[model samples]
Target: MPTLTRLLSIIGLIVTGAVLSMYLLVSYVEPEPREIIVEIQKEGFE
Candidate 1:
C-alpha cells in the first residue's frame, strides 16, 4: 500500500509539472490572427 501511494504521488508530480510548463510556454508565445467568411441568404427573411 505504501508503494502504491508513493508511485501515485510521483506520477501526480510529473503531470502537474508538465501542465505548468505547457501553460507557461503558451502564455509567453504570440498567436496569429485568422480570417473567416460568412454568407447569409436574403431569401430567409421572406
Candidate 2:
C-alpha cells in the first residue's frame, strides 16, 4: 500500500539523519582528559 511505503520512507529518513548526526559528532569532537580517583572500604572484601 502507499501508506505503508510512506511510513517506511519516513522511518528510513529519520534513521539516516540520526546516524549522520552521530557520525559527525564522533568524527569532529574531542574529549577533555581528566583523572578520576575512587576510595573503596577495605571491609567490603571480606
Candidate 3:
C-alpha cells in the first residue's frame, strides 16, 4: 500500500491546512462590542 499511504498523507495535509487557516482567521479577526437593552414593568408602575 503505497497508494493507500499517499492517500492518507494527502488527506492529512488537507486537514492540517484547513485547521491552520481556521486558526489564523480566528486569531486575526475581532468582534465588535454591542450593548443590550432591557425594560421591566411592575404591577403599579408603567
Candidate 4:
C-alpha cells in the first residue's frame, strides 16, 4: 500500500540523516588514547 511505502521512505530518510549527522560529528571529534603499562613478576629464576 501507499501508506506502507511512505512509512518505509520516512524511516529510511530518518536513518540516513542520523547516520550522516553521526559521521560528521565523529569526524570533527578527536579521541585521546590512554597509555597503559603492564609488569610481570617472576617467582623462579630463568
Candidate 5:
C-alpha cells in the first residue's frame, strides 16, 4: 500500500510539473507575423 501511494504521488507531481511548464510556454511565447498570397486559375474566377 505504501508503494502504491508513493507511485501515485510521484505520477501526480510529474503531471503537475508538465502542466505548469506548458502553461508557462503558452503564456510567454509569441509567433512571428507574415503575409501570404495565393494564386487561382482564371477558370475558377468565372
Candidate 6:
C-alpha cells in the first residue's frame, strides 16, 4: 500500500510540473487587438 501511494505521489508531482511549465510558456504570448471600422451611409439605410 505504501509503495502504491508513493508511486501516485510521484506521478502527481510530474503532472503538476508539466502543467506549470505549460502555463509559464503560454504567458509569453501577446494578443493584439484589432480595430473594426463601421461605415454609415445615407440615413435611409436605417
Per-residue lDDT of candidate 3, residues 1-46 (tens digit) = 9999999999999999999987666556633212111122343365
Error of 4 at 25 (Å): 0.1
Candidate 2 lDDT by residue in tens digits, 1-46: 9999999999999999999987666556633212111123334554
TM-score of 4: 0.62
What value does the lDDT take at residue 10 in candidate 1? 100
Each candidate's number of clashing pairs is 0, 0, 0, 0, 0, 0
How many Å off is the CA of 30 in candidate 4?
2.8
Query: Residues 1-46, candidate 6, lDDT per residue (tens digit)?
Result: 9999999999999999999886666554523212111223333366
Off by over 4 Å in 4: 31-46
Candidate 1: Cα lDDT at 32: 18
How close is every model to the real structure, measured as TM-score?
0.62, 0.61, 0.63, 0.62, 0.62, 0.59
Instruction: Give me the displacement of residue 34 in model 4, in angstroms.
Output: 16
lDDT of each model, Cα atoms only?
Answer: 0.65, 0.65, 0.65, 0.64, 0.66, 0.64
Candidate 1: lDDT of 25?
65
Per-residue CA lDDT of candidate 4, range 1-46, in tens?
9999999999999999999987666555734212111112232322
Model 5 scores a C-alpha lDDT of 0.66
Best by lDDT: 5
Q: Model 5: clashing residue pairs? A: none
Candidate 4, residue 27: Cα displacement in angstroms equals 0.4
Q: In model 1, where do residues sit more than 4 Å from their true spots? A: 31-46
